[model samples]
Target chain A: MTVAATSIGTPGDLVSATASDSALRRFLHGLPGVDQVGAEARVGNLATRSIKAEAKRWALDLAVRTIDLTTLEGADTPGKVRSLCAKAIQPDPDDRTCQSVAAVCVYPDLVAVASQALAGSGVAVASVATAFPSGRARLDVKLTDVAGAVEAGADEIDMVVDRGAFLAGRYGEVLDEIRQVKGACGPAHLKVILETGELATLDNVRRASWLAMAGGADFIKTSTGKVTPAATLPVALVMLEAVRDFADLTGTEVGVKVAGGIRSAKDALRYLVVVHETAGAEWLRPERFRFGASSLLNDVLMQRAKQRTGRYHSPDRVTID
Target chain B: MVRRPAARPVRGGERLEVRKTYKLYVGGAFPRSESGRSYEVLDGRGRLLANAARASRKDARDAVVAARKAGPAWSGATAYNRGQVLYRVAEVLEGRADQFAAEVATAEGLTAARARRAVEATVDRWVWYAGWADKFAQVGGSANPVAGPYFNFSVPEPTGVVAVLAPQGSSLLGLCSVLAPVMVGGNSCVVVASEARPLPAVTLAEVLATSDVPGGTVNVLTGRTAELAPVLADHLDVNGLDLTGVAGDAALAADLEARAAENTKRLHRAPGAEPDWTAAPDGPHRILTWCETKTVWHPVGT
Candidate 1:
């Protein structure tokens, strides 16, 4: 990890202890603003790339491997968690060609249950903490929440950023909150959620992206799935660009996780194309790029089955997680 | 150049024929097959006519979505309004009589006169169903004299979305026979057209688009029934299946019926041998096939 305690005048250091608050503000504001129309046009252009036949088959399989299958409902029960875990381990019972997903994400209370159900399976157990969808709780409470999930065997912690703080121009406070959550995560990787839906603007999204990376986030995520415009293509494009630029400056690779509203194999493939073109092939792997979704896996599996059998697969055959 | 002809001289009668490209009808728009695959449709004489969209299972799923999206408003439409819509479809089909007759003649190897007669009968079938749209409830629903001091009545309501397998042999008449009745009851449908003769089915979709019938109310897909039927059968969103086309194939019908049991969808299967679609009894059976009886009770004394 790159140290935040560095000289202020260093060219690429985003977080320097010697830099005054005004200098830090200038550094963030000095970052180029996004051209919304151009970015969306570029995303739309990339979405038209036709990955057919063998390439499509490969992309479908890789998309299945990149999913962090999530269930964040308040009515979540042990039975539901167990079933989701079972689905994560063996997505398609009839087709062994389907791979286990990257992880199973759930509420922190069910972390132990998911961990136990997914044991011996390579699928990691991810839990949403830090008061989850809304990071409105006290910093101590948020840290405790992260600690509890980590103590319960959560292999990855998906923590939401304090949007109110970030929006109120308390950038230092937001950065410190992420740092504390990272410290609380011990061995588990920390995924800092920017919740771009509430971030208000693409410039804010970019600034938050840099802030999260500087605060030592292992992965910068797009949303919590509770907001209206969660994980849109333009927002995802900006986040991907942020990670690419961060890697150039700090030389530390931070991952990206796009959550919410992605529901089809076609949509997943489009996101894969964006990653392939913008972030290059290195982020194409699950370790660097992930899709935080619940319904996207089944669509991918269905497409994979279609590719294999030369016909469409029935939705009833797959478990309805 | 001695005498300038009254009209420009025609070079060797080499006029270019603009062959129509058939596409799948979904959610009111005409789109090519999502799978980007098409099958060659040949005339009975083994001559190529046009390439018909070969819809895949994804297309079947999309049709289900469209049917579901169109179901609520369609089922809630006034019976008289629905009758008007059906009559409008008949009107539109009547205007395109020669095109349909030519297609039917080419597809089925029928004489021109016989094909024109079939087209006329198909148009009449729509009119027949148009009248039934407002009458099925009165003819089918009833009030029973209950033992208790409660007034009970059985009313028929549309059963949401339906999937229809149009008859394979009588492509035009059989298609109109199945489609008109199912839609007359206010139930939206996704029809898998006759595999060997799909031209008239898509042509019928063009007619429906111009009629007063709402978009997504009737989605027609042309492709292999064997490949597309199972997906529709297993679709949980579909409320009913009309297996009129698979009447003779007992094994295929049984297989589809078993899959439909996943959602407990209502099934309407035709008996073996093609039915006389021009007969008078076609109206009640097809409409009632997809209607559910809801019984509501009211106390006698206010």
Candidate 2:
């Protein structure tokens, strides 16, 4: 329950001794490949679940609380980060029925500002580190990035996996890098972003998901929101399946976070359905599930307004951050 | 001749008439009023006609949002394509003429002949506006003679989302006259139908949905103008107002225009009295009312 200061496990010993290169390869490759058409069909089917009335109201509120409200712009200033923190604290200032989001995700440099702004608020400050969006920087630079954010009082650190190492069949190197970032994150919980768009296949997504969870990722994220096809239903489904399988094998639960392109209350509910049916109801908690999105919060608020007032809401009535 | 027993009702072959449950048209979907309240629409002789959705102010705000969302794509569409789409609305309306005429006759207490004339005039007005969709820019825009060696031209662009209060008395003809011109220049609109006679508006919305018009392009809400107009007027996102329907209530009209000034929305105040919609002009002025003139300058080569 207390993810902020608790370390999940030690890095090298996290996986079994059988995680040697060939052994890891055999384990990863032997993991079942996904049926693309079947996966897509399942996602489409789950999307049609008509969540209405009380269920819709509950989903909307939970979605607001599950959001990792993000602002990762090159132009993000302290003022913007502070306002985002305020938004995370009280999403709908006009209506008190709305709730605060889970976290405020910003670049590493603005972690302190967000942490201070959201000091008393239950919302956490999550930082995107490890040369985020690319993960192309050297291992030492990535570690410093992690350490700096942890020093700035970040409760959570979202680090990207090195796609170059993974695509080149350097699976051990990828696992090792995640371990290094996890080690650098002293008390901060770690979320390993797969950036599944660049990973090329469902098999790659599955392997990366297992690799991150095996490397002691408190949560495995879908994307950096900088890539096309980020955080899709099938990819999230694969990650969810991986976490479920990993828990079955090791008895440790690693959470799942789906980021990017998820803009509507309907879309959030669909992902929640995937989480519910695939990973069970336990993963429905904020500590276990998160949506790394900015616009998604507003949509959830709008839907909540509709539910409360029994009328469709306007975007103008909500703040335009 | 067939005889039916009073107790047994032996005439079992009689067909039951299925009446429609008129609802508010938002985002191209016919959803009942969110408030779940309905009011009886009656014929002029006070006979029960059907129950119409009593749309709330929330519905008005929703209509504005839908119109705003539909504004860009509808405006970016080619003028020729827009004209064709508008023409298709007229085509669909023509096919449903009998239904519209019946509703008009019942709502207005008009003779069948007069109701048919109203439908004809409404269809003709659409065709008129359809033709102007592509031609209005040419007549309204111009190549300005600049002071320096520059080629400057002014072109009309849609003024975003406009909110219209459809005439209460002339529900069918007046609705078409006010609605068509707002859309001819590519602006999307949220229309509050005639309070007492909203059946025609709902029927027209059905026609629009079946035609080539995109979802959210023209949202129709059946509700009290006094209750809804204030919301639309104060809605910061709405870009323009057509107050022709509020001509009879001067105080209400003044209040709405003042509230509209909060966002400096473009106001088309109601005329002293509802202009004879049957004799409404087929000119470029109405189309240009909700348009912004954009001027571009390019340097001339030697």
Candidate 3:
């Protein structure tokens, strides 16, 4: 039993410590209950603000995956995605940036290609398997997808929840299927995406959070990007709270990813601030955190370059993947 | 010599006696089976009071839809409000104790006074469930710790619609025993009321309809027990089931459980061993059951 020594830190600055603990506690208390924390914590202290130069640069490389089993709808999309991967991915495996991209997401079909392309790089090759976006396919198909992705050297597998099964209130079916998929992932990380906009409620969104965690999701992602109203702070906050609760119960920590449509350094920093107040300093490290976005890389790199050189560079001048 | 016709079915002084036919309680109305089907209900003396509603698969589904319509608002209701409604149901049951006693006496072969005690126990069960309406979550839920800087918690949530088999003996008390816990936790249930002594079951439905209990939270379906139990148990949408009503049918109850397993529905089958109707309560039967615990978490940062 790993008893967490409640290192509820005591700084001599009673006001600041009180503020920090209460701020943290308030975020913790508000995490459940389905109501949104309308205002983001504006961390203005000199220490908090120095503040986060690198966190502002975080972004997730999502796989808006398209699998062509029959090659029917968006059948040729995989090959196009491959070209984009080769173009946008770091061709040389030796280069390491100030931060790793969130993940190089791909379909199980091209996990091999993306794995090979991203080989020897810290950028995790995340595959969208287990019936991506729409998980109506059979359980065997979903398990095989997880197995195939891990077999092809995927570092992480983002599986979509069976929206059809869950919405029908076949919660046991949904939970069991996810458990099977997580087991199939072997050592590879599992991220369960709720595809929230389709779920349509903050209450349901919260419930799905616990279901995914209970189902062995190593991370709970916000959306599939196939749906609208992609990534919002409220949804991300709910997912973050889910991870914290799971960690407390099992002593196994979860990772959180806010993917889809996150495009600016400002938004990235906002995510980091939310995390800092909700989780802690240790999560500030990129290993536990990721920003999934196709467009966030350039903007973050642009900001990083500006921080280093004391001046912002032209977007064309930055080396972006 | 011609015996004088009875003033009521009661062998002694009893006002508000139960009718012969036991019917389904749907939408605040007691209606005979829409299917026009009824099976004979035999009291302890083996005399028929009336027929009971042979609740069909369609009736069960329609009841579920009604329950679902009422579920959210009912579940969303404050725990205090739910408790108040449950207490009100008890009050309604108390004022009509004489009617319930006759029904129970016919249903269980009890003397009038004993039947009154049994009905009071049934009424008391509502008060018990009412107290738990809001507190089920705090007791069952927890929080989790994830690696990230975020807050999280797990809280208990209602599993939506449920199906119940009201206890066969102790008809009034057992029916209350099954129905109170389900509705107390904010889930609506369709009960296949006891076939042997269904008069009280139908009478109890009338009591529920008037207590502002909402139309669909508790539904009583009286039919051939073997026929209706499957329809409720096998229902894919029915989230949970109770078998307190089937006292001697272990094999059949097991079969129903097996069928319910298709949806992984939570099954609670009270043992054939008759519970002391006057006892405190069955832990599983009397306590709130099958709550979904949702834990939330947040990051602890300096």
TM-scores of chain A in all candidate models:
0.95, 0.94, 0.74
Encode model 3's per-residue lDDT on A198-231: one tens digit a residue: 8877667766776777678888888887778877
The candidates' interface RMSDs, in order, read 4.8, 4.7, 28.8
Runs in model 1 lying further than 4 Å from the true structure: A1-12, A15-18, B1-23, B32-61, B64-124, B127-172, B181-188, B192-214, B222-276, B282-302
DockQ of each: 0.17, 0.14, 0.00
TM-score of chain B of 1: 0.94
* Per-candidate local distance difference test: 0.88, 0.88, 0.67
Which ten residues in a row are the worst by lDDT in model 2 chain A? A1-10
Candidate 1 structure quality by residue, lDDT tens digits, A1-321: 111223223434465631455655676676778888888898999999989999999999899999999999999999999999999999988888688999999999999999999999999999999998998999999999999999999999999999998888877788778888999999999999999999889889988888898789999999999997999888888888878877766678999999999999999999999998887899999999999999999889878877886544556557777
Q: Kindly report the docking quality category of candidate 3.
A: incorrect
lDDT comparing candidate 3 with the true structure: 0.67
Q: Rank the models by DockQ, top first.
A: 1, 2, 3
Per-residue lDDT tens digits for candidate 3, residues B16-65, read: 64434456886556776767776766778887656566777667656765
lDDT at B34, model 1: 93
In order of lDDT, best first, we have 1, 2, 3
Error of model 2, residue B33, in angstroms: 14
TM for every model, in the order presented, reads 0.74, 0.68, 0.45
